[model samples]
Target chain A: MNIGTRSFQFHTPAVIIDQHTIAGPLEKQGNLTAEIDQFIPDLYDDEKTYELCYTKLIRQTVNILMSRHPLTTYLFTGDLINQSTPTHYGLMETLLVPVTFDHACATFGLSLQSAAFMLQQGQKQTVMVGTMSHFAAVEKQFRFPNEYGQQKPPSSQTTVTGGGFCILATEGEGPKITYATLGRVINAGFKDPYNMGEAMAPACFDTLLCHFQDCQVTPADYDYIITGDLGAVGQAILFDLLVHEGYQVNREQLIDAGCEIFKDHQPVMSGGSGAGCLSLFLLSHGIKHLFKQSLKVLVIATGALHSPVALLQTPIIPTIAHLVVIES
Target chain B: MNNKLFHTVAEKHNPPRPLLKNCVMSFIFGGVICAFGQCISLFYLYFFDFSEETVGDPTVATLILITMLLTGFGVYDKIAQIAGAGTMVPVTGFGNAVIASAIEHKSEGYVLGVGGNIFKLAGSVILFGVFASFVIALIKLILT
Candidate 1:
């Protein structure tokens, strides 16, 4: 389908899903689960109880989406497993057929490959790409560095929960994926986990240039562009770097969903991290009007590919972005 | 009638219509919004058995989401008009503006449409905030 002729329609059912799935794990984990139990005492009852609740939650979410778009095939995005654990992955896999999964190093390549594969297969009319993460699970698995010191960073409080789903149909009723281009991953092979902004710079520049080249669209052609989960510092660095390269984006139109999700009133000092951030924005605000108004939109979902293991060894974090074009 | 006495009588009989209405509406709407927040917090506390700390995150997220949805439905503008900065200054207010602005220009395409419009209301705020903070930091560095 030609980009101009296509009409894109998309829906985002973003809300808490499958809280019960994590319940058993929390109970099994014990220590942190006890701490969480203190806050949500009703959740502490039994290990099996949480599993039941989350299972129901997941079922409810699936049912809701199914009712809304019954024909759409589901795609589970990354961080369906919070810590890259087998159990988390298993739980997510049970909920939906896994098209593909990648963490840290190969996430971008795998995501693009899977997206391309789906587009080619043409088996499903509509594809739903969604992701969810429990902050408790993340905290339990990796003691978010901020929590280590005596004084916790203020941004720790607004930890997000919930899943975001975007329904992509082959019929081109919604925002069309104009270009899902993958830039060659430039591995800095650096090992510092705390400052991901520095490490991911090389990849960010490379991917961005590749995207611009692939679309034959210069930075000026875009009205506004949003990057997924670059946090505060990374965003700052991105803006500076882009300007240095002489491709200045209007600061107004250039938004970071992470920044929007973690408004100043909330204690989320940096910003939200995960697939949910980008998906929610696209569904809630991105597709709804942008598609209707005929405004061209570029939604870039960037991921910092760093595992706890990688962080322990080297601070360098691999990053990837899935760029989709939405036009009215 | 004496001029002073006449003025006093007019003032007593008729206060500004718009001003009075605005004051009343602000109080009622403001109270209602606050009450909703309180209700959500309490609900989390009671039914969900969530602690004060744990309840805050969900409550805040729910409020933001509600505001975002309202902005999507175009109901938030009416609420904002009635409440003025009372509704716009809070985090919920920010969400309302961001979503509403994006929705307002959603036809452009994701990159141009919603992405561009995402900052309609908060654009100035972010700009000024960053500029001011940077200036302040620079000044502090220079002075120290």
Candidate 2:
């Protein structure tokens, strides 16, 4: 699927007609409060275990999306968990063929790109792309057990506890997914897991550059160029990089999902990260603009593909950023 | 192309780490925890009629109990979050680790959840700790 210069221009645009979002309490209080479909006070959505809580979040989101768009082909999903078992096990009731993707925080971008590309290729009439992330579960798996209460530096990001499920189809009246630029694994000797924002910022920059070069469009062309989970630290780095590269995009043009997930008063260190951080934010906030057809949005979802085990062994954090253009 | 692009952007941004600051924070955090334990030991030594050698067991037990209580009360985690690795170096840190494991698995149920998973992280610490001390003593005997 190497379309052109690491980008794909969909012949038949895949439209986002319906979507659902589930956010954590902290996120619910953020700017995107009104747009989020559901927000639980705590991670435990009446489930005994954190894993079950995470699974229930995904199941509930999918249930909502499925209800809205009953006529679908399959489901493309991912989460910040091992094997994506929570999503796999939770979607037992749905008859949609499930395909799980992993690119750390950029799972949603990968899923969305695949869905749109599939629809363009006429592989399936309609598909769902979703992503989920639970802070406790992710903290336990990637860094420390949540209760361990390990000290987090200002560079460290808080993993968002939420999920976003979206529906993409050829027959719809909404923001159309018109372009996609897949990222290549770029290793720049960034080994520290605590500084994940810096680790993925480079990838975000690279993917955005590639998309612009391929589509022959400038940053001003889109209403917002949203990057996934770069947090405050990475967001700063992105701005610096863009400036150094001679890209004169304003602050309004570049928005970060991770930085916006938490309120300014919240003590979330650098910002938010995880599979759901960007997806949930985009589904809730970006979708409204997309539906209005008044804005063309560019989403450059970034992800750190390194696992803790792999990170300890190597100093380089391989990162990816997938690009998707949503036109009104 | 990807490598070049990565190099360009990565070279522009180096992740910041306040190493000196972190080291100091951790030292103070750990130092404060030790100071607390010393105060507890002194309290017991002055109030009770225990010899220096005899005071070790009771002081350690009391310290563990107090820390376990703090962990249960949901105060220790907040302290640990601020203290960094300092909280984990002392006996109370081990106590915190054990309680954390217990709380994490509490949702799984009593038998399968709490009881079974209570030792997940602490089990290895105890196992290697006792074995290492025994090995050290054996080596000391041979050397002496």
Candidate 3:
């Protein structure tokens, strides 16, 4: 049911039944390596092209989830690839009905929100929510050739090569999706493509504030408030924005998935940013932490909604963020 | 917050780049590449019957060959990240740009892919280089 503007409260909250996350070898250097269910071993994944490898990530993730939950009725998934081909092409064999959602790195949040709505409406029994992103494939589409010699600015983020999948049902014994706040396209008049965290931070702030207002809960109500793929810079900016708005933001409770995914040793300038960044961290690390104790977690997944063509037309990058409240 | 205020906050959070370090690194690595080229030119002068003027062509070819191999081996980008303009300002960077595009497009096909997109990055370099030279030549002729 609709709560306030841009927020929804699921009457019968959707529950996560099971989850499986896979990442590339580079992600093994991170702190959550043990939490990840599987690793792709390399970028190629025994495929001819990086595009095909991306498809493999989606295929393998869904196939694993489907095998665990054979009664899944639908697949809600997306990626950063052009036309979201990886999700469509990967699920060619899976009999589940596919619905593609694209909101850049926030694809996972969109997928989760929609899946929860479907569950609450009794439209589907089990919905498999998933998202994939490959470093080489996304680089070819968004930036430069893999072999091209280019220096990325400190604001730039590494596109994570991974996929995360989870099964959601109306009645299950797992994390419950209770509330979701849909974010509007917020353009803060920032234009640099390399500095995506800054471009997307305002959207995070908007959705987060909306979620707090609509849910009637303060930051202290939740054990943790996680933002998707904001990296180090955006995290700082988000803190400043919240504090400026007369809200007290606990530094320990507010963490970014991008900063959590990569260690300082990695060459990633800011940190990891991709559709999988949030999903991978949530499924792997966040979920485990929730199970350890009684906690309420707020996940605000953010995305920079601009294409190479769109960037050419308007240098400004418009961004969005989706908020999901998960409880143990 | 308004767009203007948000910009101020964003800028405040963004850490500045290490400009001095980049400049010093670029200068050192760029000099090293040039010194390596000089060694190749000197080798040609000693071992082969190439003059100072004629030596330019073979030396350039050798540098391009080395760059192409590095690009193919996936080693050039890592070095270029640290070297910055040091690796990019040289002719070798031009060769790597072309070869990198060709390799990236190989998955599409050799005919319309590699053949068509080979000059995608380097096309502007060639066009502008020739145009600038032509303009200089016309100026010289007029002065004579």
Candidate 4:
């Protein structure tokens, strides 16, 4: 049933049957190394290009799931590339009708929600959701080429080079998909690409309020209330805004995937980021935290829905946050 | 008010940006890059037996080639990350930038992807650089 705002309450069960996370060498060195399904030894991974490297990461992840479990009915996925063509073209041979959407980092979250909705309606018995981001490719398209050697400010996040996939079915012996609270684009008048945390923090706060009010739940309800890519600076801004809005999120439970992936000393300025950032962490390290029939999580996957072309005309970066509940 | 709140929060977590640290690192790296070039020129004069006047072109070409290889190997970017402006001032920086663009576009294939897009970042620099130098040299000739 639809809730008070842009949120849903799924009465029937949509459980994750299988999952795979393939991290690049850098992410392997990060804190979540032990939980990752596979550690790619190099950025190229024997491919001629970064795009092909990204495709291989996702393809291998899908292959692992297919080789072990029942085939998912459809595949939903995306990446940070322009038109998401590289990702779509890469997965075309899989023969699964591909659904590609780009809400930036929130692509994974939206994919899961769409898959869960389809499962609830009995239109699809099972669905596979996946996403990937290659650091160099993303650098050329979104910012300057890495070789350009421009100094990005300290607030900027390093887009992770990784991929993750999850297969959810109506019948499974795992965590159940519960609710999805869709977010609205909120701009707080911050205009620096280098300081993206501030640009996206208000949107996170707005979505959190919407989820809390519409779902009639508090922070204590979930075992973990994770933000997609808030990083260090954005999380602090979000925490302050939440307190100002009269909502006290559990400091212990309210963590960010961006901060969790890398170690403290790692040179990742703010934290881990990209479309793969949240999913790789969630599907790998996060799932381990879920004891069967014990843990509940709310993943608020956030995205800054701004293009370089759009930024030239306006000094505003609009942001969105999509939240989904999972109970194990 | 809200802006104040954002700035305050952003400032609180922002580790003091070490301007002096960047300057020192840049100076050291820039010196190292130049010293490497000097050694190459000396090797060309002594070993290759090239004349002092002819050494300029070969030394620069070698520096560019070396930086381009470093760019391909992803070492230049890491150095640039730490060395900052020091890496950008040398001719090696330009070489690294072009090779990086080429590598990023390699997936689109060599024709339209690598060949056409290689200079998208550095094209303007080449254009204005040659143009500006010609104008400055013309003015100098006129003054003389």
For A86-149, candidate 1 gives per-residue lDDT tens digits of 2243345344554546543223223433454465466666555555444434433344211111
Candidate 1 vs candidate 3, DockQ winner: 3
For model 3, the superposed segments whose C-alpha errors exceed 4 Å read: none
* Per-residue accuracy of model 3 over A1-328 as CA lDDT, tens digit each: 8988989999989898899999999998887898999998899979999999999999988998888889887888788987899888988998988888779998889999999999988887789997889999999999888999988889899999896899999887899999999999998999888898899999999999988898787898998899999989998899888888888778998889899888998999999999999999989997776556777899998999999888989887999999999988
Give me the displacement of residue A303 in model 2, in angstroms: 1.2
Task: Select the stronger candidate by DockQ from 1 and 2.
Answer: 2
CAPRI docking class of candidate 3? high
Per-residue lDDT of candidate 4, residues B33-132 (tens digit) = 9999999999999999699899999999999998888888778888888898899899988887788889777778899989998998789899999999
How many clashing residue pairs are found in candidate 1? 40
Model 2 lDDT tens row, A212-316? 787788887877888888887788778877776788788877788888878888878888899998888888877864347577888888899988888777767
- Candidate 1 lDDT: 0.51
Candidates, ranked, TM-score: 3, 4, 2, 1
Model 4 residue B16 CA deviation (Å) reads 4.3
By lDDT, the better pick of 1 and 4 is 4
Q: Between candidates 2 and 3, which one is better according to TM-score?
A: 3
Cα lDDT tens digits for candidate 2, B1-144:
444554455545545566777778779988887887788778878999887788888878988888888888778878876677788788888888888888877877889988998887789999999999999999999999
Worst 10 residues of 3 chain A by lDDT: A286-295
Q: How many steric clashes does model 4 contain?
A: 1
